[model samples]
Target: MSTTISRLLVANRGEIAARIIRTCRTLGIETVAVYSDADRDAAFVQLADVSVAIGGEAPADSYLRSDVIVAAATQAGADAVHPGYGFLSENAEFAQSVIDAGLVFVGPRPQTIAAMGSKIEAKRLMADAGVPVLPSAELDGLDDAAVQAAIDGVGYPAMIKASAGGGGRGMRIVSDPSDVLEAVAGARREADAAFGDGTLFAERYVAPSRYVEVQIFGDHDGNVVHFHERECSLQRRHQKVIEEAPSPSLDPTTRTALHEAAVRAGSALGYVNAGTVEFLLAPAVGAGSPEFFFLEVNTRLQVEHPVTEAILGVDLVALQLAVASGGALPDQAAIGAPRGHAIEARLYAEDPAAGFRPSIGELRSFAIGGPAHAAVRVDSGLAGGGVVSRHYDPMVAKVIAHAGSRDGAARQLAGALRQATIDGLVTNRALLVRTLQHPEFLDGRADSAFFERNDPAALGAPLVDGPDVAWYAAAAALAVQAYRRSTDRHTAGVSSGFRTVPTGPQRIALVDPAGHEHRVSYRF
Candidate 1:
C-alpha cells in the first residue's frame, strides 16, 4: 500500500499549474505539464520537466478532456495526476478516471467528491454528521403550492439555489412570494447551463453575514486536522476578491468551535489531501455567540491557500504530496497556532467600472513592486508581453502580503497594489487598492455585500498620475529612440537626443487614457 508518486502530471493550466510544479520540484518529484494550443508557451509549460499538448484552446477540447489527459499521462509515464482547482479539479469522474487508469489522483476519493458535489446531498450529509446546516427544501417533483408552503416555512428573503452548481451561477434571492416561481425557474435554467443539472433547492438567505471557511487535511489513517479559519467576507458578484487568514473578528471560543465543526465534516467524508469546509457566520446577537451554518466543501486546493501557508509557514501543496504518498498525518502539536496575519488580493484583467467585464489586450507594461519596508508575494501566470485572451479566466495575478497585524497586512497589500504599474489593459488593481484601504475593510466591518453597499463609482475612480506623468512618458520614449540610434551603424556617432537635424520645435502627439489627444512642443 505505497502512496509514493514518483512522477506527477499536473492536470491544469496557468498560475495554479505553476504553483503545483514548484512544490513538485521541491519534493524531488518529476513533473509533467499538459497544455492546450493557447497555453502551449505558457509559463507553467516551460517550467515542467516534460510537457504534452492536449488539444485546441477551449477547455472542452483540451483541459476538460479527461480521457485525453489520462492518455497523455500514460505517454509521459506519469505515476499520478494532480488536478489543480477549477477545470477538472472538483470533477468526480475525472478523479475516478485517473484512478481507473492506475494512476493516483492528488485529491479526495471519487465517492467523497460525489457526495459533496451536490448541494442537496451535501446538506443532508452535513446535517447527519452533527454539523449546523442551513434549512433547505428539496424541489423534487414538488408542485407550485407545495413549493410555496416550503418557502413560507423558511420565511421570506430566501434564496433559490441550484443544487448542482455553485459560484452563484444558479442562485436567486426571492424576497417576494410572487417572484418565487420565476426565481426558481431562472435558477434551474442557469444551473442546467452551468452544470448540466437543473435541480433546484431553497434556503433562507442570511444577510449581513460573514464568510468564514476552515482548511482541513486528512490522511488514510482517519486523522484530520483543521488549519483554523479564513475571513473571506470581501466579495463581488458572489465571488471572493480578498481573503485573509486568522479572521480579525472571530473570538477564541468561536474560532475553536469552527475548527471542531470543520473536522467533523472532514471526518464524515473520510477526506484526504487538501479540502476546505466553508461556513457563513450570522451577525452576533447581544453577547451570544455567532451562529454558523455549513455552506459546502471545496474538494481541492483554493486560490487563497497562500494566505494560510503564510500564517502557518507550511507548504500545503507539499503536505498534499506527502499525504498522497502515504505519509502520516501532521502531528497536532506541530500544526501550532497561526501567527501574524496575511491578506491576498486577486488582480484580474477586468474593468471594475464597467460591470467587471473582461479586458483583453497585450500587457504592455506590468510591474509590481513592494515597498522596501514590507513583505509581498505575487503569483502570476503571464508576463509583461503576455496576452490576456478571451479564452480563459480574467485573473492576472494574486498579490499577498503578511504583517504582524490585520491592519498592517491590509495596508501593506494596498500599498503594493497602488505601486503596481499595469498598462495597455484595464484591470481591477485600482479597485483592489481602494478596497484594502477602505474604512470598513480596515476596521474588519466589511461583509460579503461590501461592494454592493458601497458605491462602485466612487471606489473605482481612475488613478491620477499627476501632470508629470506625461513628461516622464515622453522622456522614456526619447531615451528609447536615442538607444536605437546609437545601436545603428549609420547613426552610431549621431546623438538623437541632441536634435542633430536642427528641425523646428518637435511636436509630440500623445493620447491620454480617456481617449483624448494633446500635442506637446519641445526644443533641443
Candidate 2:
C-alpha cells in the first residue's frame, strides 16, 4: 500500500524545520509550518508553503502541544507530520495522537518508541537480543537499602539516569556511598519535572571512553541497515559538540562489530525510519581488543545526523519520508561503503568562557564562507538581523565539511569556521576551531572527557588578541564615522573627521565578545 503524502506539516521549528521543508520540496510534497509567537517571522516559517500559528512563545504552549499541532495539520489539510528532532519527537503519546487523527507520523511506531523511551527497558531489550550492555538495575520502587545495594552491585562511579528521557537531564554521577540516596532523590525529582516520569535506574559509568553511534534505518518491509558510525566523544555537559564519521579511534574489527551490533539491536525492535544506536567504546588496552557497550537507542533522528549523511552521500530525510510512505528500504549493497570523511561542528550562541551561558540578541551578521570547491555546508535558520530568542535552544547553526581524508576535513572545517562572519552574539566558534586543530583531537586521542582535560576558556579564547583589538576598534570607529558622514545632511560635502579647529583625536569605546572594553583614538 504505497500511499503518498501530498502535504506535510513540520511540527518543530528552527533549522531542523527548514531542513525538513527542503526535503519535502524535493519530494514534491506541499509543506506547512507551525510556529509559536517567537517564530512567527522566522526563516523556517517563511520557507514553508503555508504557515500556522499554533500558540504562544513557550514550548508547552506551542511546539509540545500535540493537540494543537494535530489540529493545525488538519486545518492545513496536511496528510502527514514530521517532528523534526526535538519537541514531541520521541513522545509516544504524541505519535499515537497523530496516528489516531488519521495522519501519517514520520517516525517509528508508538509501541517501538515506548519500548526504547525508557533506558532501563531499552537495556533489558538489548541484552535479551544478545547486544552488549553495561550492568544496570532498575530503581523505580526500591527502598533506601535496596537502592544502595543496587548501586553497590553496579559498582562505584555509577550513573543514575532518568528512565524516560534523554539529553543528559535527571542524571547524577555517584562515587561516594554517602551520596547515593540523595542523588537518587534529586534525579527522581528532575525526571518527574522534565518528563513527567520520575522512574530511574542505575548503570556503571564509563570514563575516558569514545562516544560512537551507528545510524540505522528500517522500512515497513522489515529491513534494517547501518550507515556506519560517528565519533561524538567531544562533549560538554553530556551533550555532543563535534561529530565525525568513521571514528578515528576504532580499529577495523571493532567498527565492524559495532555496526553488526547496531543492526541486531534495530532488528530486535523492528525499528522503522531513522534511529541511532549509541555505544560507549573503551579503547584497546595493551594488545586487547576494544570493548563496546550499547548505551541507548535514540528512536528518532539525532542532531549529529549531518555527518552521517555527508559520508554516506544520502539524504536521510528523503529516505525517512520515503519509508514513512510505505516504501521499501534500499538494498544494503546499494548503500555501499563510506566515500570519505566528514566532520560537523555545532555552532551555538553561547559564551564558553562564561560557563557556556546562552547569548541572545540580533544577529547583526551571520555568514559562513568556505572554499570555492563547495565541500562545506552550513545548516542554519538565522540570517543578518534575525533574533535569537531566549525561549529555545541557542544553537545557531551546524557547519559540516567533507574531504578525502580526515585531516583534510578537519583543516577545511577549521578554516571555514575561522573565516566565518558571525557577529553580535557570543558563540563557541573559537572553541570549535581549536578542537578541530588540536593535536590530541587530530590524533583521535580525545574522549568524552576532552573538555575536562582541556579548559574551555583557554580553547575558546579569541583568535586575535592584544594590539589586534585596537586595530579592529579603530577600523570600526572609522567605518561608523564614514557612514555618519555619508548620511549627514549638515556635512554635505565634508570628508569624515573634518574639523575647522584643531582638536584632540576622537575616542570611542567598544566591547568585545568576552565582555572586555577597548578604547580607540583616531584622527582620520
C-alpha lDDT score of every prediction, in listed order: 0.87, 0.91
Q: Estimate each model's TM-score.
A: 0.94, 0.97
Q: Model 2, range 312-391, lDDT digits (tens) per residue? A: 88999999999999999878888999988999999999988999999987887888864552669888888544889999
For candidate 2, the TM-score is 0.97
Best by lDDT: 2
Q: After best superposition, candidate 1 residue 177: deviation in angstroms?
A: 1.2
Backbone clashes for every candidate come to 1, 0
Instruction: Tell me the TM-score of model 1.
Output: 0.94
How would you encode candidate 1's per-residue C-alpha lDDT over 1-524 as one tens digit per residue?
A: 46778899999988899889998998899999999998877888999999999999889999999999999999999999999999999999999999999999999999998988988899999999999998879876789889888887888899888887688899999999989888888888899999999988898889979999999999998999988789898888788899999998788888989999999999999998899999999999999888999999999999999999999999999988888888887777889998999999999998777788889968877767645624698888876547776788988999899999988888888888888878778888888888998899988899988988887655766665678667765775565555666678885665544564677665666665446565666665
Candidate 1 local lDDT, residue 247: 90
